[model samples]
Target: MKVIHVGVGGFGKQWVRVLRSSRKVRVVALVDVSEPALAAAREAGGYNGRVPCFTSLQEALRAVPADALVCSTPPDFHREQVVAALRAGLHAVSEKPMANTLADCKAMLRAARETGNTYVVSQNYRYRPEMWTIAELVRKGGIGAIGQVRIDFHKGVAFGGFRAEMEYPLLIDMSIHHFDLIRFVTGLDPVSVQGTAWNPAWSHYKGDCSSSVVFELSNGCRVVYDASWCAQGDYCDWNGNWQIEGTKGTILYRNGEIRLLKVGPRYKVESSETMAPKPPPADSQHFVLADFMRAVKNGRRPKTDVYDNIKSVAMVFAAVKAVKTGRKVAVLDKDSR
Candidate 1:
């Protein structure tokens, strides 16, 4: 597969690296609005040998023929770039938070549907082995029907860029991963969201850097999430700390360790099992790239296809609505794929 990658900024560089390492796809063109970023990505992507770089996806597409377009641009730019790519009859893979708005997500979905091209959102957390194990355990009834889930995340990093200027930095940019993870692990679709987003006094970002959200899932599970990007003290891993409660037991995951606690006949902690961390089968992007290739080849929807991923993106938008309106908002129902 030949690919034209858009956006060569911070996160964009990661996409470039993944494309260079991919055995099934070749990045034939690089596109970015910034010339310096384009040059850096060209060197960092290790495609310095006469590969074309352009400042715009349109120009790049006009100059080259490619099987797919990888969109690593910001959320606001995703709709235009991805819709254009799909309309051009190329399969597209976009970074998380498919687009800034639900309307844009739906539009992208419609474009991909009309074009009969694969549109995948890279929710890489789903490809982790631990996440798969959690999903499998819940599916197999190891913990019975999940009733509640709690996730707490804290990280202190001074991000000095456009992210600092975006609205709801924590909820839109970071919390989407956890929201998607909740749905992925519990096999539940979000029904409603209630949340508030705020920024600490010491924070540098203009957008909210902290958030608390309560989500009601389709399966009667309640997920409570609290996160901060400006925390100063002890912090959880990038994946966050998770506590899942089910009818029969509970599952705890923190610092890359998994532990299960089951109730005893006497109402005590009967069994406790700790699982050693298992490496993923491949890099997250590799998994996403491979699935995209397979779906294109088999003419089937990929695991994180836009139709399915829109739910996760909706969760973010719904949460933002809740924060703004000071009331709960319903998540959009998934349309027929």
Candidate 2:
């Protein structure tokens, strides 16, 4: 696939790295608001200067022939940039959050529909081995019916720029990853969400860096999300610690380990077995790009395609509303205003 890559800095650099390593992909053009960022991307990705650089995506699209446009811009830019690509007869692969708001996501989705072009949002966490394993177990009825899910996502880090300044940083910036995983692992759509966010007295961020978000799923399964970005001590891994309980069994995934246990009559463990995560065919962004490329080639919608991803984006906003209003907020859908 020939591609035009936008936003060549920060997470965008990682995307450039993945594109560079994929033999199936040829980056036809680079687009960034910063000329220095474009130069840095070429240097870091070992790209020859022959790959044309452009400060404007419009110019890049006209100058280069491409099969798809890879958009890694900030959330606020996603709607316009992705819509432009779709209108230009190019499939779009976008960074997560889809956009800063659900309304923007809908606009992008509308563009994809009107243009008849595939638009997929990159949701790399859904491709994890643990997530796949959990999905399989639920599909196979290893867990009769999901009842509840608990997640503890505590971390201490400082990634400056947009994240530090954003209000509800933990909920907006990080919790969406966990929220998407909840939707994927259970195969259940979120029905509603309620949550709260706060900043610790000694926290560095201007925004609240701690939060507890609760999601009520389609199957009446409740997912309680307890996460903190300004936490101290005993930091959980990025995937966080998960305990998914169902009618018959429970799956405990902490750090990188997975354990499945059968439930007895009175909530006692009837049996226990430890299982290693089966490796996914492709890892992280590699898997994401591979899926996107295949979808573009096949003229099919990719996994986490705009429509499917909108629900996850909605989950984030619903929680945001919940935090702000102090009430349960219903998750909206494609037809929502």
Candidate 3:
């Protein structure tokens, strides 16, 4: 397959590296608005003078023979880029959160629908071995009827670029991963959300760096998610700490280990055991790219296809509304809104 990859700085550089290593696909064109980023990506590997380079997506679409497009641009530009790619008769994969707003997400989905092009969002966390285990357990009733889920995420770092200035940095940029993960694991759609966003006085970010959210899922499960991007000490892993409570038992996942505890009759303490995670199928990015390619070839929707992922984007928007209004906001589906 021939590909056109956009954005070549920061996370974009990583995407370029993945494209360079893929045996089934070749990057035919590189696009970036920043010349410095383009030159730096060219210097990094595989995409030297042989491949065409453009500063604009429109020019690349007109000039390149691209089978698909992999976009790593900012969330705000995702709608324009992905819509253009779909209209150009190219399948597209975009980094999450799918878009900055629900309206933009809807527009992107509409383009894919009208063009009959495959559009996928990179919800990479769903591909992890641990997540796979959790999903399987929940699906097979290993944890019984799930009543509640708790996720606590914390990381202390400084990436002083677009993130520092973005509003609700923690909620918009990071919580989507966990939100998507929850949806994937429980196979439940979110019904409503109540949230609060805050930034500490000592924090460096201009926007809110911390948030607490309550998500009501379709299965009558309540998920409490708390996160902070500017936390100072004792941080959790990138995937965070998670606990799932069911009628019969509870599943605990912290750091890299998974544990299951069964409840005895009459609510007594039963047995607890550590569950082993399955070997990962492949690297997360590779899994996503391979899935996209397979979906395109088979004329099927990818697992993280935008048609379904738009709901995850809706969850983000609903949370934002909750934070602003200090009230629970309904998660509106496509037909309703």
Question: What are the per-residue Cα lDDT tens digits for candidate 2 across 269-297?
Answer: 98999887875799888899999888877
- Lowest lDDT sum, 10 consecutive residues, model 2, at 328-337
Root mean square deviation (Cα) for candidate 1: 1.7
Q: TM-score of each candidate?
A: 0.95, 0.96, 0.96
Q: When superposed on Cα atoms, how far off is each prediction in RMSD?
A: 1.7, 1.6, 1.5
Task: Give residue 68's lDDT in candidate 2 (0 to 100).
Answer: 92
Instruction: Arrange candidates, best TM-score first.
Output: 3, 2, 1
Candidate that beats the other on lDDT, 1 or 3, i.e. the better one:
3
lDDT of 1 by residue, 63-137 (tens): 999999999998899999999998887899999889877788889989987998889999999888777677777
- TM-score of candidate 2 relative to the true fold: 0.96
Please rank every candidate by lDDT, starting with the best: 3, 1, 2
**C-alpha lDDT of candidate 2 relative to the true structure:** 0.87
Name the 10 consecutive residues with the lowest summed lDDT in model 1.
275-284
Candidate 2 vs candidate 3: the TM-score winner is 3
* Candidate 3 C-alpha lDDT tens digits along 1-337: 9999998787988888888888999888989999999998888855679887899999999998888999999888899999999999999999998888778888898898899999999988888888888888888898788899999998997968778999887788888888889888888889999989999888999998899999999888999999999998889898899999888888899988999889866866588889898745776778899999999998887899987887787888889889989999998765423
TM-score of 1: 0.95
